[model samples]
Target: MEEESMEEEGGGGCEAMMDDQNHNNWGAGGYGRHLLGPAAAPLGNSLLRGPAAGPTADPELSDVPEANGVLRGCEPGKGGAGAIAAAININASTSKFLMNVITIEDYKSTYWPKLDSAIDQLLTQSPGDYIPISYEQIYSCVYKCVCQQHSEQMYSDLIKKITNHLERVSKELQASPPDLYIERFNVALGQYMGALQSIVPLFIYMNKFYIETKLNRDLKDDLIKLFTEHVAEKHIYNLMPLLLEAQSTPFQITPSTMANIVKGLYTLRPEWVQMAPALFSKFIPNILPPAVESELQEYAAQDQKLQRELMQNGFDRGDQSRKRAGEELTYNGSSACASSRGYR
Candidate 1:
């Protein structure tokens, strides 16, 4: 009996050792059924039969804890909540920024006429005050207003009037060389340049229009000549080199900048195109590269072929239309003659 008890104890020690070894190996290599073999089943069964097998009991109910202290002072009858709510309501109302809304109808009926009258008043002011106003200031204000208002017609008319005014004022300043007014004149010129910048797109649009319209050659020639004269007189030749250099650089010229140049050129009127080759050669040599020059010469030669084709097409269409009209007229005349012969 003593031997049997000792063997049973030895067997239990062996199983514990095996369980420990399996647990260590499982930790090292991760848990797997193959690692435990038959050891895990006995250990799991023994734990199931222990005190942990009993069902858990429900927790006892308890009362809520009292407050540490009461409010320092309390009103007997008046509600404090009403005053607190009123304070919140007042805060909410005061938090918003004030905004003014003007409807489109109100703008047209009330604001626009008033605005126009104000502008006219400023424009027609006495020469003393008007002359003192730099061309730059007038132009800047006009452009800003035009942009804000989205008034294309107003913008165009204002620009034309301002250009004419600047021209007239520039001449007047030149005639009556004011000692104190030199700075003012320079400022005015700067402002005029700003105005020109604003109207540049319009100039480009007009130039394309004229080109497409195929205005008379004589009128085109005259306009080119006028432009040339203006460029020479204005010392725009000096400015052109800088503009060319700017063009060659990586920085792109804005539409406004291009418009200014185009409009400036346009204002010089017709004579400028004739002088373009020489002017460009002197100022913007990069534009007339050797390859481009060669291409232009080639294009000139091809121009004759293009012109001939155009002329032939026009002649064919005109001749066919004229012949058809003539035949109709002749047939009508013969019919009248036959009627007269019958009457006789």
Candidate 2:
């Protein structure tokens, strides 16, 4: 957690807002099995990953952000047995962790119009080809909001608007082709999360001090809630099977962690269970064991292929044997962009 030192200007600095799910060692929510357990997944039940940020009272004047931070997510291939289910994205977003002390009236009149336009670009633009907008400016705007005396309302409204936009994006995702839903989700989720992560730090000072402490919520939690509710769960319902297969790769995960995976599943979206009790009561338990077994067989086949390559290379050899295996077999894991903890 980054601490804020108060100054006259009261524009403040921020730290990276870490992900709710990343390198979680609770051993409670593995990538595969626990979804069959029950509702109320323990995942992210604790909102503050590390230390809470500075008090929400008032901020210092604006300066450059402290650093860049990654939005934690499962990359295509990363982690151990339970590592199969990757996070949203490991891409870094500038934590424009800052504050500006300006009145809400100024925020509404002077800054918001421009900020709103930048948000429009964020929503309308395509992946990697975003309309150029200064993230620094957005930080400046939100920072100013935090400095005002009546910032709680400001923050709430900001979250409401942001949520509305995300809901729009979610509705758009639903229009995509059924086969292309995951691909579309990957693209949309990446872009939206990146945008949200970048600007979130602007609200961090207030979130740490006032919002989380007083309102019992923070900017990170609200953004994640919007995604989990509006976007992630719908697609995850379809993608769960594939995620289980991916996590079970190499067969390194134990049943303990596999149970954690089930926990992770229950957390994805609980509303699904309420709407259709059978999804969990009927389908999950019956299917998951077989799924795990099937993934084990796949891992075994890969292991055998590795064994054959070793034999072909005169086993018990040096790096050359390993190189040969890399060339011959798909291998246990692929390259992943990951962060162990914190923003970097």
* Candidate closest to the true structure, highest TM-score: 2
**Candidate 2 structure lDDT:** 0.48
Per-residue alpha-carbon lDDT of candidate 1 for residues 100-215, written as tens digits (9 for 90 to 100): 11234443454344434444444345333433333343333333223223233443444454445555654554554333233333343444444344334333322222322333
User: Across residues 172-252, which tens digit of lDDT does each residue of candidate 2 receive?
Assistant: 777876555545555666576667655667556567656786778777767777778776766666655543453444233
User: How close to the true structure is residue 296 of candidate 1, measured as C-alpha lDDT?
Assistant: 64
Error of 2 at 63 (Å): 43
Q: Estimate each model's TM-score.
A: 0.22, 0.43
Q: Where's the lowest-lDDT run of ten residues in candidate 2? A: 56-65
